[model samples]
Target: MNKLAYALLTCIVILSLSTSCEKDSIRVPVQTIELSASSFTLATDSVRIVVAQLSPNNTTDTNITWTSSNQQVAIVDQSGNVKGISPGTTLISATSPDGKISASCEVDVIKWTLHKGGLGFVEEGINAMALDKEGNIWICGQNVIKLGSQGAWLMNNSNLNPSAITFDNQGFAWIGSGSGLYRYDGSKWEVFTTENSGLKDNSIITLATDNTGRVIASHFNRESLLGTGASEFDGNSWKYYSSANGLVYDNVISMAIDKSGVRWFVTTNGISSFDGEKWKSYGASNVGVAHIGLVHSVAVDSNNNKWFGTNSGLIKFDGTKWESFTNQNSGMIGGSVTAIAFDNNKNLWVATGAGLAHFDGVKWKVFDRYNHPVQDIRTILTTPDGKIYIGTGLGLLIASLRD
Candidate 1:
């Protein structure tokens, strides 16, 4: 009886020991954990899925909780779903129930690209232009158009007849309302008319500002009591220009101020330049203008080279010689130059009645109906981001500068 009982007890103890060993092996901790992606790159405001793999090929508590070092840069959820919040780098980690086992992934978030869109509510042509300090360009025609993030916004469709609109250094918006000049002082409108304020005439053709913060406005066809051409407002006082100020023409159409603070006026007769106190004249008989009449607009380049848009052709005056570029000589596909602007790269862009043309100082690029998008390129404005805004009789065309 002792020998059989002893053998049976020994067998039972051995079976219990073997069972204990199997349970101990099943309770072993995970050696290491890894993520499906060691490093992840995603665009801002986008999301991606990730997974954590545990070692030993076992499903013993395979579920993992995810976290991010920087929630503003990137965010992760319990299911290992990662989302990019902004442009930055963050470390995303997956942790088990115990702090001893964890896996990490580097997440990089990139910036969102700017989308270029169109602004197309104007059934009529866009004629006037005004640029603000915030890099916003406003257009005026039958409607008032403003640039928005999505596209062009037609702020006001009624015809205020904004022949000109400008922002003074003091941030006052001056809008020409045909019979009177309206100034928007943040919220209220202050009207300045010939009968009320010191304005020379009721019709304000164009307004210009100098580097010295002097605002000068020209009358389309008004005679001043002082016998001058344009009215100058020094924020407090007003003055006029005419024969008394050495100005030969009183019918001023356009004006431009150079970087050197010299203001130039273009009239039907010719051009006149003023530097605060001194004045100079350049008529059709002048050497710089070269008897060329019908100048529509004038612009000064970064190098102080004067460019004139004329009905016949484009003229450039480098203080000494006169250079002419017409449809006959250059690659300009349009006639009747209307507007002129320069891009960030210093490329001169011109809008004409027929098409648009660009000159890179050596080569000329002409855009017409054959290969270009705009036909009647009336007013051309180049944005700081290299987008070209062409306001035509039909609608607006935005061209990317990257192309």
Candidate 2:
């Protein structure tokens, strides 16, 4: 009785102890598995990749499975090294015994390059440039030159000592030279001078067209006559304006038509705006034009901002306020801004007497004569492909902003 009872009691106690130990083990906490990356970039020639994992709750499990959607594009290793083999998109995933998490990135193996074209001159000085919607370059300067693809010269009129040239919506080229206005109809030139047309004077400084194809020319008397500032060609007749006719100055330098069809004139005195009925003048005394006299050129940006290149510096008008920039405040490179053009990227390219200045809305980068032959940049033009052509006294210089 003693031997059998002792053996049975020991067995029962050992069974009870084993059951308690199993229950205590089941109460132990479970940890979570997390995945992370050092970097998401992958090289084209990489063979393997490395990824890190942190098991704050499950410190015993370090083994994880790496997966990828496209093995040809990229493949991951146990260490999380993603090797890029080709150009494609793939999803990388990591899994552990506890849970699974994933992160993905693309791999492009082909090289990216930006090709820029060479520079071409107009053969003669460039006075102005007007681009058509068809990518045809109509250059109005001393010589009437038209350029297109493959360096093709569509029209090269050496007889035109053009002072200002503009293109209408009808593709007709209106040229202003020492003579009067001339229209090129893609075949021949039609001369319109004071001989028959109603031009106030023979010398035309600038030419602009309204939305209705009405042409306007800024005329200055070579003899320095006062009260003879501007003239307009209404398809048939010419109308002249001056101080006697409510003009601020008799010597007009530039002309521009705003988005609202309002004509703006820059004269030797200040800036004048004409709404086809009334004329309003603004100068240093009233607005912040930098100078009351000698406003050389005027251009309107896509945002309806007015840019004035005056004898003093550059002035910008935001319809409500005027902001002036010079060599001191802005990296203008020169005090006298001669021409201004806005590129497709909304960057303002300013040509001054010293060099070329580029304003990316916030920052300014000045390219002087030392870095580029930008001195005496009389005109700034942008091609359809975003290439910049600068017309200077030296000749025509081209550069690419993408580079």
Candidate 3:
């Protein structure tokens, strides 16, 4: 009786233990899912890994399916890695295999968002860049390239050898080229020359528009008979000015108009300003303390202050006073200033032969090949939305200044 009772009791205990172990190993359903990030931004052709946390930590089905709402904007693999394809917004979701529990993250993909350039596209570097009324970027090189929501596209303006471009008050694009002045009204292109319009010469080089809706064109010609000068067009009539008139030099490098409608022109030797009736010229000799030499570009800020970019440094003239900044005193990256522009936040961005310099009215930030991928910056332009378009010898460098 003792052997039978002991065998039965051992079998019952062993069976009970086996049943308990099976119950402990049973699969548990996931109650919730949480992602490591709620929102993030990534550049085009960039990737980021996000982790998912499942509730009921001991759930047996821990597998997650990653998906993107817009594959053209972004793509998510099975392992929760998100890759940006283009510029737009997309939703990335991590869901349980059964599709009941899920978590999502908002992703913003930007193109040329980082320290990237248009190497193969904008070959030979971008000669000039401009922003249209719709916030589209128009770049001139060997050809015309447009960067907008549809991406980059070539305009190929019939090999006109476009040198400069500007937008008029009506949003019409006025391009100065080797042959003549070309105007684009968003659809068609029209050419203006000495024979067709009021222009005295056909060789247009630099162009600018004033707040009064007038287009100013500068022409450079080496021929003894053709000459070099600048022209003003008021939609109906043309007025010509040259060194023979009041300009300090005939070869104008760049031009800009101040807030008071005074046109400022920069030449290789000096600076000139015309107020529709009189022309005033300034040189190193007349402007005391202003290191004005080999002036490459000129820009008028919102305060009507004239900023000149020169081979030696930068000069600011407030009509009565003059100020100068160079690599020796300021944090300018390069000695030779090529271009200058102001952003939406009133930050001044300067392009030089060596690198790019940013001045925030109090502090200065220099970006060169050592810290940034861009160097030999030829031109810099800032849009209203805080995008900085830099044209360099390597290519076109695009960056954002938004906080």
Best by TM-score: 3
Model 1 reaches what TM-score against the true structure? 0.64
Candidate lDDT scores, in order, read: 0.73, 0.71, 0.81
lDDT of 1 at 4: 94
TM-score for all models, in order of appearance: 0.64, 0.67, 0.69
Would you list the clashing residue pairs of candidate 1? Answer: 228-241, 228-242, 229-241
* Cand. 2 TM to true fold: 0.67
- Order by lDDT, highest first: 3, 1, 2
lDDT of 2 by residue, 1-403 (tens): 6999999999999999999998766632225434453223343454545454544654444566677887876787877767766544567776654554344434332111111222243454566777766787766655766667767463554566777878777878888887788888778888887778788777887889866788888776667654357778878667887878877877778888998888888887888888889989998888845465678889999998989998878899887898888888876778777898998888998888776777889867665544453365677788768677766555556664332
Clashing pairs in 2: 48-81, 49-80, 49-81, 49-82, 50-80, 50-81, 51-79, 51-80
- Model 3, 1-403: lDDT tens digits are 6999999999999999999999998989899999998876676667889899998898976987899999989899999889978767789999888888899998766555322345326466677889999988888777777788878877663776677888999999888887888888988889898888888778777888986779999888846534387999989899988899899888787899888888898887788899989999998888874568688988888788888999889888998998888989887877788889999888888888777777877766665543355566767789887678887666777775323
Q: Which stretches of candidate 1 lie over 4 Å from their true place?
A: 1-123, 150-159, 221-228, 288-291
lDDT of 1 by residue, 1-403 (tens): 6999999999999999999998867754566788897775565566788888888676465666789999988898888888878766789998876667898988766542322223554355666677777677777676556666666775543456677777888777777656767776656767788898788887787888766568888876444432236888887889888766677687677788888888888776777888888988875666654435766788889999988888877888887888888888887756578888898889999988776677889866655553354566667777777677776665666664332
Looking at model 3, residue 203 earns an lDDT score of 79
lDDT of 2 at 291: 66
lDDT score for residue 84 of model 2: 64
| Ranking 1 against 3 by TM-score, winner | 3
Pairs clashing within candidate 3:
none
**Residue 351's C-alpha lDDT in candidate 3?**
84
Each model's total of backbone clashes: 3, 8, 0
